[model samples]
Target: MIAGVGLCAAAAAATPDSANAVVNIYRAELADGSVRFASQRLDPGYVLYLPGERVAATSDRTRAGTSAAQAVLEPDVLRLAHRHGVDSVLVLAVIEVESRFRAQALSPKGAFGPMQLMPDTARRYGIAERAGPVQNIDAGIRYLKDLLARHEGNEALALASYNAGSGAVLRHGQRIPPYRETLLYVAAVLARAQVIRNLGQP
Candidate 1:
């Protein structure tokens, strides 16, 4: 049986809502056949076992503006990045450029949530609720991790792929795509990432 009682409690505490509030639950079957549960899918092994019955009402901070929303979501960003083996600063940068930390952000192209994930990308990662903060960041970070791996840790190429599609990267001789928007996007994310990293310094 899945020994998830403690894990479930931990998951609930990690969310923005009250500890008693309903939260999404995910299950992972370990190699030894044991099962684990978490509020967020920390890795590809975990799958959503139960969607939360009620979504948390938008917090006032989230509604105020980008900085406020970013402050509210930063913990999740850091946690998910650490769990998924991606740079937290890089994740923050992506979120800033994509949706400016707005949980319910919807792009003109139909990308949803803080990470601005396209529907196909969200579905590929088993994320049915793209507007949920934890779900969106989890899916986005995992996708970023895959892109980083595919590009051999070359963030530029990975970011370009994130913006223009991996096929575009491949078609362009595995270089950053030459599209103006993609070029600007890659530059902006990298610069923002550096800014975040520098902020931690003396």
Candidate 2:
């Protein structure tokens, strides 16, 4: 099980109305094809993606652990990144730095999932289910694609926007913010991406 009981409680406390209540706990498939429970406070502007047709049955979670799951996840993330017109290496780097491929990872700042998506960021991308690995990864990459477009294909500025808010980047004259966290995030992602590319993970 994922460590989400606490998150569910936090979300339930945040919204009292059943209609608008945040889902604190939910089940989603992990990269290893196992279902795990997760919890996070749902941000406004996101609604569930209820498919019209019934979906096929999901896979059981393999006990082979993180490495096996990551092996599955990397190619999936790379495919999604390509579909979104973003570099697969960049997405891989972000995943490494953000949550180290842990689909259920959550930050103290309330960023949740492998891509460490802030609540507002997830909402903006229409990610109804933040706990699911595939949904979360797709949402993050879609956001990254938009950021890249906004920054005229400049990876550094795009990464800065991803770390800090785009508003912050614009306020700083459309440059990477000087904040230490954002700067380090940009550098680390770039460096890691170079390493991945060097190893021919493309």
Candidate 3:
């Protein structure tokens, strides 16, 4: 059964069931590690909840034929975002707009690794120094969480910071700044996020 090999490949990469994902959020420390005190597997929009904001995500490579990428990443991201009180729906939208789910994609602006951080920003976020998918994802998650915190939980402002940096957002007085790319980026992320949030694919 030569066809069976293809099936096995697909099955191996199949996304975990949202209802069955082992989801948890932990408080991580650079020195002492971290632990999860609260956890759950069920939350509406745990698959995608579009918070009203925009940010440029990478291309859609991640969501390509691989098929299972969203299923795998969405639930994990949602759980972590929920832990930090971040809206998973909005985050998924941003990811869709930004990376198109392309994990290994690189941006022209010197953003590297997944989540597409500029080399300098990646270093600051503790990614450039590390070499692994988990490290890259952790760095992105932590940085996004920090942005959410800085903007008083306003997803739009936080997304602006993610696009243009915190200094720019602060200079603009906690508003989504006027940078055209960032502005359009935010709008697209918000819209697509809404799409996936409503889709709620397993």
lDDT of each: 0.67, 0.62, 0.49
Model 1 C-alpha lDDT versus the unseen true structure = 0.67
Model 1, runs deviating above 4 Å: 1-66, 129-131
What would the TM-score be for candidate 3 when compared with the true structure? 0.60
Number of clashing pairs, model 3?
18
TM per candidate comes to 0.66, 0.66, 0.60
For candidate 1, the 10 contiguous residues with the lowest summed lDDT are 11-20
Worst 10 residues of 2 by lDDT: 13-22
Error of 3 at 114 (Å): 3.0
TM-score of candidate 2 versus the correct structure, residues matched by position: 0.66
- Which stretches of candidate 2 lie above 4 Å from their native place? 1-66
Order the candidates by TM-score, highest first — what do you get?
Answer: 1, 2, 3
Clashing pairs in 2: 8-24, 34-61
Candidate order (lDDT): 1, 2, 3
Best by TM-score: 1
